[model samples]
Target chain A: MFGAEFVPLSLPPLVIGSLAAVACALPGNFLVLRRQALIGDAISHVVLPGIVLAFLVTGSLGTWPMMIGAAAAALVAVALIEAIRRIGGIEPGAAMGVVFTTLFAAGVLLLERSDTSSVHLDVEHALMGSLESLIWLDGTGWGSLFDPEALAYLPPELPRLAITLTIVALLTAIFWRPLKISTFDPGFAQVIGLPTTLIGLGLVSTAAMAAVAAFDAVGSIIVIAMFICPPAAARLMTNRLEIQILWSVLFAVLSATTGYILAGYGPLWLGADNTVSAAGMIATVAGLILGLAALFGPCRNRAGAPLGA
Target chain B: MLLDAFTLGLGYNATLVTLGSALLGGAAGVCGTFLFLRKRALVSDAISHATLPGVALAFLVMVALGGDGRNLIGLMAGSALSAVLGLWLVQKLTRHTRLAEDAAIGAILSVFFGFGIVLLTVIQTMEAGKQAGLESFLLGATAGMLKSEALTIAIGGAMSLLAVLLLRRPMTMVAFDPEYASATGMNVSRIDMLTMMLVMAVTVVGLKIVGLILIVALLIIPPVAARFWSDNSDTVALLSGAIGAVAGYTGAALSASAPSMPTGALIVLSAALLFTFSLILSPRRGLVAAALRQLKYRDQVHMRQGLLAIALQQPIYERLTLNMLGKQGLLRADGVPTDLGRARAAKALLDEERWRALRTLPQFEAAAARYDGLTDLEQILTPDQLTEIDAHLNRPHGVPA
Candidate 1:
């Protein structure tokens, strides 16, 4: 199992997928609790234009530029939703619908018109992702962890995802108290001087960061699925917020590992020669987990429990 | 060339596709009005997104069974099955969980779409999968649509229209007030299911035309636009259908003319344009119209107050008010109220005093009904009666005047 082929070809994707899943799921718990789960979906769609525009201007697929572009796009999406709601007097969901779809359409048109072959960001990859192709072979085996020479040659996506997951973990740990109070009861939190608005913005920005970091590795569909599914499933399984977070992390890891393996080798067992999309499989597995949990979870009858209770 | 495109001289394909889109728009608009009224706009989104897996699975099964897998009916069956399942899941989640409707919709939409992507990838890896043309269902490809497909859409649209016609009264009743409808012996849930089935029909047919991503706009924007124009449900539904038709025809024509523009996006943009126009300029609920009414009311109030001041021999606030009143024949231009102006000013003063008294008195709350019935000027309290009530209310508690 620890052979050279296994370490390079298979290990990287599993690790990358798992890291991406964990990164997204951490912020997703907050989103699900706040009932703003769809904002993750909207951010994923709206970031397409930002990524494309960043590539067009910089003429490179560098990580920092793409992340910056994605962040700007996410901000624009949130701002546009607010503006549409206030000016047009439309509901928030409808405002989100109008903004994200229009932005996604604009992204598609721009991708079609521009020269994006150099960046490897085409329309298909924008929607489905190119997860199968992210392979890493710097050195051999577990020993390469300490070898600086080997680390230098590692796949860029690996370290990017690792850093993103770390930042997400650090932020969640730092703001854990405020996040819980503000998300559960903003009025009381504000009355107690908890800076509820800033906490809310911080949470949204953290979700945006995770979305952009995972954009190239697992794509938006998996980002959206992981953001909602595991947390939602975990939510069904537990009542305590801390326990829910633990369950969510566990579910995210399970889906990412199992789904990737299924996508790669499951088809062979079914007599097919080629493997399927790892990102799609991961999402499907997450959905399956969520469906099962919804049916048999601990909180099935306690569905009407108050938020954050 | 522009004229040719405008006149639809491009040929039969453009004409057929345009007509098919028009029919779809009309049906979706009618179904969407009920959905919107019931505050289920995002439910359509969830249903449409959920159809993706069904479509891909249908294609795969058809191919596995030794067929080309391009059969429209097979694909539609798969889509309808999944869409209904998605709606059921949404209903269950909302009913059984602490999740709000938006969270449930968001969860179902992403998960189903993700599964669809998985199936699509699986299909992609199979032999001859490239020829399946399954990807077009994501964003739509109107140019590739055949006349037969167009005909199928038209037939589906016609069925939805017929259903709405047959169930108009009950549908409206349920949409407006389901509790009342149920009290009146109508099966509210069954009626809701029937409406959802109609919406599912339109949504499934619309997938090939507008695609999954933008189809909800076709369903939502038209009826919302029509709402600004009419108070009657029937009129709003009719106007919604008309607007949908226009949007479909124009969007298709523009797509045919400009070859590069995506048909679905253009259609949604057209609908958005119509919605913006209605929001700003509609006569009943539009911002511009409401603002004009406010300005006119302000002018009338100013004129009335100025005329009262003059009749009571008090100070005139604005000099132009007296001039405007005289021009309107409410004043004699001699800085004194004419006979008509005097009567009008006294009535206005009396009505103002009565409202003030109504606001300050706690015991007179029951007299609100009397005040509502006294809209006629002759029925208003006399000056002496108004002064007596004012003096009585102004005294300290329990002190009789």
Candidate 2:
């Protein structure tokens, strides 16, 4: 449907989105097994404060500083949430609700107070990253080797995406067994002397970083769509961990491509100014797929069933 | 201050918001009591997020129908309709699919919120000027509250209270033990649905106060906080409602004074802080009470050990009078052992090494009788303090005959 010009425009979003998907999926596999599926929701909202704080200090969207800061704040949030659960005797879900919402509120207030630009680089940018702009940046200089051999020089972001995905792959490979055991049965894993807390903290931080990465493609709110939807959908199709991870990755990649292509063409066909956010559309699509899976998956119990017979 | 707050001047608008939010908070508490018992504490959360699309669509329809874009009726109708749809979808997905309840909630929440965002973006483009006021529902805008909204909240709050009063007996029975109620042929699903509807209604009422995002806190924190104060279920529910109302009013007032303060967060923080206090100092179940009980028990065990040590030093041949017992460190040197002194000196150690077996039983009586050669001091110790001490001592022996 698109000319050669549009194909290249679509490639960066797809590439970055796939990297985000892979990153979110690796940790999300365990998050689901740990029954912390909604943890992404908490992390998405909670990381806002750190992003705002980082921007206040740096006054720009420098990725590493903001990412590192957000990751740290997310870790603090996780620790505080755990302490609230243990010391205050609050339920996990409620504790999460309290911590994340409070942090998000603090972030919003901080964003308003910061004398930064009117564009609201803290939350709005994080939620709707400049995927459109990032996809078309000029790859100049000796960056020629990083180019796609046949088509054109690769965007600098392509290599960053690769590095992020590589990090995710390496971590998942090294910690696969411990992560799996810990996710499935934390109590037993703790009894066996596995450092469940460290693993848990690592997973939470990785999810936050995945959120930062996805922010560049889909934005923050839709990052929840990336983190939760595919893992949830994969859960319906399989009980085996390896299979679930594979299916999750596959679904995420497909959703990203579909979303990118659709966003590229959707506004054009409707006589609009390409205003439809690629990341937001992709998130919606992911949610749609997950919703369908939840409605048609093969195994269910009747006792706490959603609807009456 | 009260007169100024209720004066019918320009300040009346703020009063409406305060009172309406307070009433809504009470209603949420009553509905939440049943939810907590049902172990369905997360249902309100699901409904809160899932209602977003409903509100957005309602606004869309309002515009489409040539109605005023800022009408509250359109918004309320939209929320009710969408909430029902979300609930129905959740049910259908759970019944026909393999999804767990939590999974179903997650799916509904994401899809509905995402769709709501899509609609919001569409509407924002189409009706940018008129959409400014509508954003309040997303983050709550008590500044926009009027007398009419307050009246609707009052009526809804009253209806919720009346419904709880009517269903109190059945709800109590179901919450305390749902399996028993089900086995007894109570219409469990009907009761559950009705309760969920009340919870949904409560959430709808709270939309103006805490907004769409944070209403779940209203439904969760107050009732749990109240649990620490009262052992009886009815009292807990009642106290929960009171606490919620107080929190609601205070939050609105504080939010009015503090610009840029989100009302929902303030309200939830107030409730959370109150819960912390309840956890520490409530009379029956508070940490302070439990700690004090432990301290008292330890003192009794120590005192009993002192008396037993003194008694064990006595010869088997000699019969020691109450006066002779006073000479040992177990009692005061006074001829007549006071109730406190008798309590300290009559420590007959348990035969079993289990410290919990150290009750005021005949083992103590037998040892005392051996020392006094048939005195009736054991029978003299039938006081209330002694009875509790006895229970604590005999805690290991399964309620002590």
Give the range of the ten consecutive residues with the poorest summed lDDT in model 1 chain A.
A300-309
Q: Provide the clash count, candidate 1.
A: 1
Q: Candidate 2 DockQ category?
A: acceptable
Tell me what TM-score chain B of candidate 1 gets against the true chain B: 0.82
**Prediction 1 TM-score vs. true:** 0.84
Clashes of each: 1, 6
- Going through the candidates in order, what is chain B's TM-score? 0.82, 0.75
Q: Tens digit of lDDT per residue, candidate 2, span B273-384?
A: 7776887888876778878998776655544444455445442222343334455534555334446544544445432222233334545543433432123334544566
| Cα error, candidate 2, residue B157 (Å) | 4.3
Interface RMSD of 2: 3.7
TM-score of chain A by itself in each prediction: 0.95, 0.86
Model 2: residues with Cα > 4 Å off, grouped in runs? A1-9, A53-65, A106-135, A139-164, A182-202, A212-217, A271-274, A294-309, B1-10, B127-132, B145-154, B161-165, B283-401
* lDDT of all predictions: 0.82, 0.68
Q: Which stretches of candidate 1 lie over 4 Å from their true place?
A: A55-62, A87-89, A113-119, A193-198, A303-309, B282-401
> Residue A291 of model 2: what lDDT?
67
RMSD, one per candidate, in order: 5.7, 8.3
